[model samples]
Target: MVISNKSNRRHFIKKAALAVGSALLLGGSLLPASVMAELGEPEKEELKFGFIKLTDMAPLAIAYEKGYFEDEGLYVTLEAQANWKVLLDGVIDGQLDGAHMLAGQPLAATIGFGTKAHIVTPLSMDLNGNGITVSNEIWEKMKAHVPMGEDGKPVHPIKADYLKPVVEEYKKEGKPFNMGMVFPVSTHNYELRYWLAAGGIHPGYYAPAKGDITGQIDADALLSVTPPPQMPATLEAGTIYGYCVGEPWNQQAVFKGIGVPVITDYEIWKDNPEKVFGMTKEFTETYPNTTVRVVKAMLRAAKWLDENDNANRMEAVKILSKSQYVGADADVIANSMTGTFEYEKGDKREVPDFNVFFRYFATYPYYSDAVWYLSQMRRWGQIAEPKSDDWYMETAKSVYRPDIYQKAAEALIEEGTLSADEFPDFATETGFRAPQSEFIDEVTFDGTKPNEYLEKFSIGLKGEEVIK
Candidate 1:
């Protein structure tokens, strides 16, 4: 029953029409005009998408499991990648048609930060699904600096400031304050750096131009890459004292009693963008119809994930835990997926926006979101050289294709799969969000003014500064 090609589709429809005595029409002539006009037949029907085994990859899984891809005339195979680099490589090599990627991967790739490839994303996958966790030993030391609420619980939005003294103590003891993030260009890296630097603890910098991509030059806290699934294990092994990663690894820390997640990214910056659906720019250009249709299917999945106040999240958890997708325990996956995030053991709090999939137009790939990642890249020295605000805007536009997202969204709207209200108003949308000022340090970010936003940071590079 796999309708992989148009010829097979035509044959199936013809046979069904004949068997059903003209009840079904060939070429869908009897379908509504809107459905008929929905993006022409997918230029390429068979697809294989890659994703890491993280909760944010849910939209891709849902699209495959719920038949959304099939509805779009796509036959998709979802494979979980070993790590971010592998996933990115898969897409670049065409072994994978696309992938659920760290928001920075495509941008970094396009700008020649790591691998040089013109990667692009037409849809963002989710938002605010990441957390920074400290090992139990680190948490115990940090507890002294963290203020307690009247309820005797640690007051939250736990700033990196609370961790500053511990970092200093480690420094005085001649111990490097080491931590883990998933990758160099990962959102985890920047968010961890952001959180740490906000607390007056330097998380170091990357001088790629000087061959110091280690990101630990002149550091107070040394951060390294640890795969997402290994965060808890790495913490337990004492290889790293803390890490920032997406779930359910953070929750796995709580479940295993090895670590405590101190802060979710939602607290670091409210509603910050996380993963994106990335493909080679060549893939999109070669199969434009297929690209739009893939976006269409994922958009529908994102809507279903958030609709009715996450009524279907437990079901999603079940699907995600089945050993082929996220494969974490159902309880661990549900810890954040079901609108609540467990920080310390038994310290589960209501963080309804922790794992945003579709609400607030999460699926639309905004230029502003791309710019924020770029700003972080520059701030942390991944970009090496300073550029004007116009360069930032142009680079974001190159990697984030909202035009393609609009096409998919409009097609969905016309086909009655979703409503216009569910999307940004295409005509008025500037692809930039209004200025945001919700970071732990309260620095405002107007995506249009990336250089200005970078200048506001006291800890990282700004202006014409280059890592020397």
Candidate 2:
């Protein structure tokens, strides 16, 4: 939980590098000793950042609490914003220099979906830290339909299809089933949709051109926006039957005995990227070294969080339990954290990548990751028409900046703040991951083949189609 000093940044790199036994990975060219000694100073040291009450906000919390910000000669104040939009607004209006953001927020905004701004991310926060939860009534009804264990606990990573019959029942009874997620462009929205669609349920669409942004057109389950902290209260009051959101709110429901969490996004799409650290393109340009310094600190914090194979997560959960950060009780936070994610009241299972920080290059802003989000945007009709493959690639490159990430990574390596082996082979790295087939639907997603990937999905609008 400690953000090492700048001098110590170098020290930890050597220690971590040696510990990993990959010290010789950096074969000389990337960071010469001359460049290593040229650690740039922060241009604007004092700053404000914002976050929601989710556990994935831990990197920012870790950075601040551990003095990673100070280690870069930057003084920072971390504030919890009222909601996603407000937090995004703060960043857009210059009230916040940067903030922990929904991975889709910057992408959506950049593409003119909600509040249009040219926001971009140099740091992806963490991977697969969200889930969908249902009330006790829904869980009770959903259990019988779901495949169960020999021990009879309803073998999980439960599909929304289990809930689909229930939703159909509601429809047959002339009733509506509703769910809440944090935002239209949120990972929760896509995960919920993906989960539902994978189970042969139509989660609905967005016909923005028709002046319908509700996204419930031709829907079985109606999904709407509810802020993260409000998820527990809203579900408790029966305002929503179920919700898709991040921690510790899902655990908050279990603490309140109001609901059961059915599935985590890690279970939906393993190691799916979540929130990221975002600022305007102008902000990074106005202060390049400061931006890299910020990423360096965050990278260190991310590495510490994932180091020891998450041996430090228990202590991190304790830190996040503080009133200023997530503000949820320690036990509540620990439910889905600490390598065990819970479903129902007592069904906690070991899911180690539930909140990956630095391992597997989790923080790297890959163009493939950006393209996937854009594909979801297209699937959901956020983008009105069919865009060329080049459009997808170009848009991803514009928003997810691996070039900037490389500069930051290089600086850290040269300064000995991180070893060359700590990152991918920069020379051979293609900012795109190989086509992946880990989704709940078993649909292959090749970032290079977006349209073809979309064509494989049975639920989403693929190719040139539109929801009328």
Candidate 3:
């Protein structure tokens, strides 16, 4: 009888050990001698984290399913929330310790944009795993302007200008065209707006100051925030003509035959940062070691996702396909999860970096990346007022938290869980990628020279320019 109760007995002991160890190791730096002991303390060992159903949430899924969290002395329960907002709410209200979050979530929360909190991320989840899709009706309308490849599919990086005629036709017909993005401050919002504006279509502006939340004024395609998982259903219901969203969701649209993804953000900006694992500033301060441990687990998962030329991605897709994770079919998840993306059902092409987790410094939190989002916020009037270059730099530092990230990464290196070559050389890194000139319009962006780069854009509010 006693032996039969062993499972419950062991569970209780693990919890007791975690609580006792966490109390002792809360602030102890994870030096090799200390982490062995520190690993004993979870304060609370059983955790429930939330994520929206998207492939970019793979780090958290991998960390949990692969027993990496357990290796760090953490027993996790990965729950798929209904949407990003509910998932974010769970983290803020203490229903979750942490979760897969938007890159802008920590920034927006800290800055009091949507919610008032000081959320911070030590780990960036991935890079370049999003695409803009259009309903089959819209794609058919826009098809005429797109140049064809020899095989007869529309060309790569299909400019939104091709859709301008269709939008104009809608306008002439007294109809308003609608588009969907994941969130108000999401990378999808900025990327879609950037692509549309670059193609000379007014993706519209936000006057949050006027109490009008409808981000559509003087717009051809009125863009609004729809949670990622609902994107396909919403498009199918004809609520939106198309939407920009992350993987599995957009790919779901293709599988369901509701829409077709036309262009990926990799085609928009090439290896742009996506989601991140975020925690509140208070959580970080109170559970410093725990936070580091969490980061360590996630880092290992991220590396494994990208290791040996994405050897783990197929396995990751299998894990992600479970009902508790992304909850999509394995084929839908693999459409973009394993290094290639499809457009128009059969126009699949190799995009090896589409869902990068750890490779190419993807996990590092860079001020330049923060500043780029800031620039977009200003461009679209979300900031509500003009801000100086110094303001951008300071705001970036406040949200990005590169210092915290470096500490966590170094601990992993010292623990021998990862190699030094996996990260940028801290002594020599400038936190900026070289000027990238891969846009359809041929505009170059040097992260170090943000102001200059902003000025080069014919569109967008630059320098002392204010959106009036």
Model 3, 1-468: lDDT tens digits are: 000122344664576577668856886433467546644454555666778878888888777666677756666777778777887888899988888888888887887777888888777889999999999999998899999989887788899889889988998999988999989889999999989888888887676777655777667789988988889999999999999999888888888888989999988988889998888787878877677778888888998999899988889989888877777899988989888888877778888888989988999988788878877877776777777777877777777766667766777887878979999898998777777788766788766666777787666666776445
Instruction: Give TM-scores for every candidate, taking all chains together and pairing residue i with residue i.
Output: 0.95, 0.92, 0.90
Ranking by TM-score: 1, 2, 3
Task: State residue 233's C-alpha deviation in candidate 2, in Å.
Answer: 1.4
For residues 197-279, write the lDDT of model 1, one tens digit per residue.
99998989898878888999989999999998888889999999999999999999999999999999999999999999999
Q: In model 1, where do residues sit more than 4 Å from their true spots? A: 1-31
Q: Tens-digit lDDT track for model 2 on 4-52?
A: 1344455555655564465356544333556545556678877788888
- What are the lDDT figures for the candidates, one per model? 0.89, 0.86, 0.81
**Could you tell me how far off, in angstroms, the CA of residue 340 lies in candidate 3 after the best superposition?**
1.8
Which residues of candidate 2, in runs, are more than 4 Å off?
1-33, 36-39
Clashes of each: 1, 0, 2
Q: Please give the range of 10 consecutive residues that has the lowest summed lDDT in model 2.
A: 1-10
Worst 10 residues of 1 by lDDT: 1-10
